[model samples]
Target: MHTAKILIAYDGSDNARRAVSYTAAMVGSGGNRLVDVAAIERPADRDLFADDAAWKAECARRIEAMRTSLNEARAMLVAAGVPEAAVTTRFVESCRSPLREAQECSIGTSIALEILRLAEEGGYDTVVVGRRGVSKQEEFLFGSVSTKIIHAAKGLAVWVVA
Candidate 1:
């Protein structure tokens, strides 16, 4: 098999940390071609009357948070001895629905699907998501993002790291 392009969905959770560690180990050994880290930004609260300026500020803040998380993940990857050039980072906004957006961004929901539409578009071969998310309820209820990705990613391989 060709070196797989690994896409790790990072959200700063312990599960996500494990996913990163696994990716580093798997790819660092020259077993994979490339590894990309993505942090999906959940949609902002939509209040029709919300102040535009405040909303913009909030958006910037969220992006900064995502950047911080990505940086942290990158640091971990480096500590794991993965070359910086071997790893890349991406950030996708969930827009109105993070789970739905992530699904839409990848392959459509289906069994015969040959490729996640979004992953193909983004040139990712595999998608890695955490079994749980950053939410407390996610520990109880199924993680919304991972659940959606598992069901909706169709043709692409999905790895759920816990």
Candidate 2:
């Protein structure tokens, strides 16, 4: 039997936590199923910090928080009857290549792009993200990740849990 690979984008938001619970219930404890919860840590703009040391400290702090959030998500899946072995967590530090920077400026934060890349590369059939809506002006200035993913996801199934 073919296993269903599910990829969940998590950011520790309340809606993100709900997405984790919903996915666990949807997938259940089936044998032929795998779930991956992924979180992205976008680097802080260097210009925002006073010095290089401060920037480095901020990055480290962000990474630590991401790890904590991933751990909590993992526990939630396990509690929901998903086997710990069948569930995995990924913490990705978003790439800062010049091309990627340009893409982020036009699209949403690089988090959405990174999640899409992970889903495609991991051969996941479904992508799940929590819906975090913003005002029209804010969306136009800085696009919402869920909206961008819905527009860009070609063949994969996407779930925008509110």
Candidate 3:
């Protein structure tokens, strides 16, 4: 059997938690499956902070928050019978764009681009995410990450759990 590499985008939201659960159910306890739960954190804009020290501190805090969210996702997968050794967690900064001018813009591209980047770079077979996240306002303003991932991902399976 071929080993399946699954990437799950988690944000500690209700729908994201559901996506993790759905992935666990689909992947089961098979040793042939590898699961990665990742959260994409937007970088703190330099202009928003008053000083360099404060900017660094805010960045640290955001990463720590993502770590906490990743931990929760890991626990969920483990509880659903995925082996602890078969699952991993990570958090990446989502401040990149293929276009040089868009690299600094982090509003609309929350977790979608980073998830796609990781999926391709890691050679993941499937990507899973929530249909919607915690911020309806942000979705309305910036478009949905899951929607972006769905439209952008190619030659890979994507699951958007509700």
Report per-prediction Cα RMSD to one decimal: 5.9, 4.6, 5.2
Compose the digit string of candidate 1's lDDT tens values, residues 1-162: 766677787767778888888777766645546777876564456484267677666766776787888988887887777777778887665445323434433222221132244467667778876665447776356436666667777556787776
**Candidate 2 local lDDT, 1-162, one digit each (tens):** 888899999988888988998998887786678999988766677788898788877767776787898999999899888998999997665554222322222122567877898888889999999986678999899888898889889779999897
Candidate 2 lDDT for residue 153:
92
**Candidate 3 at 85: error in angstroms?**
1.6
- For model 3, residues 1-162, the per-residue Cα lDDT tens digits are 888899998877788889998998987786699999987666677788788788778777776777788888899889889999999997655453122132333343446887888899899999998986548778778788798899899989998897
Alpha-carbon shift of residue 132 in model 3 (angstroms): 1.8
Once fitted onto the true fold, the runs of candidate 1 whose alpha carbons sit more than 4 angstroms away are 48-50, 93-116, 133-143
Q: How does residue 40 of candidate 2 score in lDDT?
A: 73
Q: What is the descending TM-score order?
A: 2, 3, 1
Judged by TM-score, which candidate is best? Answer: 2
Residue 89 Cα positional deviation in candidate 2, in Å, after optimal superposition? 0.4
Candidate 1 — what's its lDDT?
0.66
TM of each candidate vs. truth: 0.70, 0.87, 0.78
Which candidate do you rate higher for TM-score, 2 or 3? 2
Off by over 4 Å in 2: 96-109
